[model samples]
Target: MNQQYTIAGLDLPDINPEDKLNRILSSALEKTNGYLINKSTSLAHYWDANYFNLDKVQIFQDSTPAEQSSILQLCNLGILEEAYFIEKAGMGYMAKMILLAETISERMLYGLFAADEVTHFSQISSFLPTPKVSYNPFLDLLENVVESEDKTVLLFVLQVVLEGWGLTHYRSIASCCQNPHLKSILQGFLQDESRHHATGVTLLENRSLGKSSQNIVEILAMFLQMVQLGPQSVVKAVEQVKGHLSKQDKINIFAQLDTETHSGSRLKLLRNLIDLPNAKNILENLEMKGSFQPLKPSQCVSFNCS
Candidate 1:
């Protein structure tokens, strides 16, 4: 009999040797967290009409000039820091794909959100003042993951691990902005991400993950190693800003995010997906590993508009 990994705070039944597909599908479902956002009919139109038009957006239309300037600074960073935006948007779809490997839930909605990312990229790209500067690095991460053998591991790497780092990035950028409009925009973009991560957690924990899916644990380990050293933006941030912030500062910032951000909500979904004790051990280990190195303006941008 194959050894089974305990998950969801329960001992998994012994692997059914005769049915391998059932075991794999069950493990995949166990990892999934159910939908949090309701799919309203106008949701798609709401996103497109609101965020796509730079002309229509007046940064904090209700705020003073001081607030507007701060928002512009953030927009500048978002424009300059386009890499993170690109990656986060792409990671939204990638996470869905990984979650897909784990469950049969929300199959149609998963495809919709994936399509949403692509449409979003197009929308965001159209509004860029200089849209010609290609972000090749973002594409490369997608290519590598899509080419990998196991969709399950790739999802955790990109969605949970990589997006976990990105949640911090979004909060920082949003906080720096004093303008309500820009902050609202950032928040709007992030809501989709929040849902995507939730899907990953749901997929990870569905009751189907039984004894035969021990490969998932090792796959998760491999994902952590890659996230710690992948070609993705978080790793890029680390490589660029490895020495800029003090160690304590980085730890404090990550911890602050743990407490303050909606990210903690996603962690709860993860806790629900995995067995309670195992989830605690794994998450605590990840937290102790500390956050990624910060990204500096000098490293992330190549063009200057003076």
Candidate 2:
């Protein structure tokens, strides 16, 4: 494994996890007025009240109380997913290879990123109503990818695609949520994710793939297809959580999710990825293979674009 990729200059601000944790704790204390409850460990103290807007989440609002409870349970599955990835990064075969293939500076940066992810997982877990679970389809996909022999593929899939997806989702959550403390925490996570995505993009662009570019494109296509199918899986998971919702409620939930997936901040983030030079090159290569059709700028419209 050649760990010799050119390092791109990244002008990221210094991040102090302790300061972030302190701010989160102070904010939680202020919100609770010093009366900490069982779940008031951090800014997550406000998660139940402001994390998901019940009224705006029309499906959750219209569903029966039991159905709503189950849906909320499905949503918090992210906490477990994050924690699983952190653990996998430490013990998974691909993660070990990736670390070994990195320069010392890159390794140090990855260490910081891992720490940030752990903080994110712990903060979210603090407020979750359900116990930590071992299964998440997306995380499973990630684990499989990490086992691949091509470390570049693993880097692109996890950092560029998955972390970019997270950055986009977190930005949307921060924008819409009412709690300042929660927003602050999300913003910090967003900064780290942005750095990770940029590093992946730079590395992918700098590498001389030659014949291997085609294989990478195929892998990216498959990963994109998986991402496209994610919402459907989420809907199924939410429905399976309790399984007593009326058919109409399920239909409504699916409809709302479809609309959000197509026109919301998530779509905006995916579209932005297409504009990346490396992503565009891959798309072009795929187009040449008759496997994909390149989208015109007009066809790539996002909610934030205009």
lDDT of 1 by residue, 209-244 (tens): 343234445444433333332112321233233335
Tens digits of per-residue lDDT for model 2, 137-159? 45545555655667666666667
Q: Estimate each model's TM-score.
A: 0.42, 0.61
What lDDT does candidate 2 reach at residue 18?
51
Please report the candidate that would top lDDT against the real structure. Answer: 2
The lDDT, on a scale of 0 to 1, for candidate 2 is 0.51
- Poorest lDDT segment (10 consecutive residues) of candidate 2: 3-12
